[model samples]
Target: MVTPTLALLHTSPVHVPVFEGLRDQDHPGFALRHLVHEDLLARARAEGPEAVADDIQELLVRTVAEGAGVVLCTCSTIGAVAEARAAAVGVPLVRVDRPMAAEAVAAGRSVAVVATLESTLGPTRVLVEEEAARAGRPVDVTTVLVEGAWERFEAGDREGHTRLIVDAVDALEGVDSVVLAQASMADAADRATLPVPVVSSPRPGLRAAVLRCAEGVKS
Candidate 1:
């Protein structure tokens, strides 16, 4: 019998280590695979979400065909498209931010979403609101984009990228919790000196993905 694989769909190479570390620490026995589409985000930003929906769907289908028992989309900007594709492909697809969003909404009435990318800001806010609605809780959501951080990340200056995110968290006020919108920003959550909880996507999201895959295997 073949081992089931947990596939990760990533827009940036930075997530490779992040998820690998999570799997090593918490899910050592699970098979892992990565599909990095570096240009997917650029295309989504230039042509809109619908423009790249088909390509994402095709990738998800291929991942499952290649033995992925489940897939996780690490890019918040393309998460909605990934969900639709996951349904069509008949495999469980997890959006990295959903677990964080659900926790953020449950943790506070007022939530702040901080992202380095403009494309992530809207979708993350929408996700938080959706989760709040599902829980029958009312939430006030705010979004912040840390300027120039993504460029620093692109240049491989992770410290600078993290510093900008930490600074953004420092600037937020009256928020019950601050949600870091990307898996790449997870480290910033640890470094933040905020009075409220600072949540990032990677750890909780990976935990959920692993659980889903395990449950699927059992069934």
Candidate 2:
């Protein structure tokens, strides 16, 4: 309560506990708040990510007005919009998958981007490429869309979702590193004992936001 200093905007309520657990384990004593906007992602999926730009911007600016020093957008479908408008939102807004994408591109030139949602895959792939461009590295990104995984997640079958994701990650033929596009798929990716490194968003993303909060850096 106390109007958390750090806030997370999420599309799925499931991410609340996932991030909370991370806060507890990694950033103890950090005040965190979670705001779920299921309809935003639903509309994005039905239409496209651009459809929810205004909604994301408005909601986040309001969150800053309420007292959150840092805002973390955890939905990949609309993450670009959130990050793009963070300065306008009046706070340091972190797009969760960006750090992971940057890390993936840094790990190697051959990057594998994996996602369960069609809405997520494209943006994540582009993000990795942009990171590569920023680093001036030539990257070959392979996008792996795990079939039927989102259905399992929507059905509240987390184990099934994780199982499918893990299996797909296992079968990846050639990639220097794997980037799990959705934070939801990260657990399964972590389960793999891959020769290549697997990067996921939540941990590095929150750490970056927390650092911004500590340094009093405003976006």
Candidate 3:
């Protein structure tokens, strides 16, 4: 029996450890490979989503060519574009926050999507709505951008970034669940002391990717 390799596409290097930890603990049998496009997010933010579509598509192609059983895009900002290019890659491509979105939609009627970057807000909200439609449920999705949090993250002030996200989670009212839109914000979900259930991408997303890899191998 051969173990399938799972490739993780990341826009930020910060997520490397998060997923690595999860894989080590839960799916140690599967091999993990990471391709980090550290500047991809900045390009998306400056030039808009369409500008990065080609780059994302090319990356997915490369990942598949490298023998990845499945590729998981870890950036919410580029998730939609990745999905658009999935057919071209001819591999199982997943968005890290996808599982979180489905969970959020199923967990409650009203869900709040909290993100540190404005670029993530739109894509994350769209994911939630799409999940709701797939589940045949009507969900009210709200987007919240934590001001100054991205700057803190860019400056390597993870503590500050997590603090802001925690505050945002605390402030979300009348929501049944809060979805942390970025993989980097997974730490915030752990730190948050909130009334509503707070969800993040790392664990659930990686688990799904591992399962996909297993399915591919079995097939």
Point to the candidate with the largest lDDT.
Answer: 1
Error of 3 at 214 (Å): 0.6
Please, what are the lDDT tens digits per residue for candidate 1 over residues 17-105? 88898899988867779889988999998887778999998888877888888898999999988887788768689988899999999
> What are the Cα lDDT values of the candidates?
0.89, 0.88, 0.88
By TM-score, how accurate is candidate 3? 0.96
User: Of 2 and 3, which scores higher on TM-score?
Assistant: 3
The C-alpha TM-scores of every prediction are 0.97, 0.94, 0.96
Clash count of each predicted structure: 0, 0, 0
Tens digits of per-residue lDDT for model 2 on 1-219? 232488999999999999999999999988998999999989999999888888888888889899888899999988987888777656578899888888898889999988999888899988999999999999999989999999999999999999998888988977899999998887886698778988889899988888878766433
lDDT of 2: 0.88
1-219: candidate 3 lDDT, tens digit per residue: 675778999988878888888888997756889999978888999988889888888888877888887899899998898888887667588788999999999889999999888988998998999999999999998889899999999999999989988987897789999999999998888788887789999899998888887787788
- What is residue 165's positional error in candidate 1, in angstroms? 0.8
Candidate 3 has an lDDT of 0.88
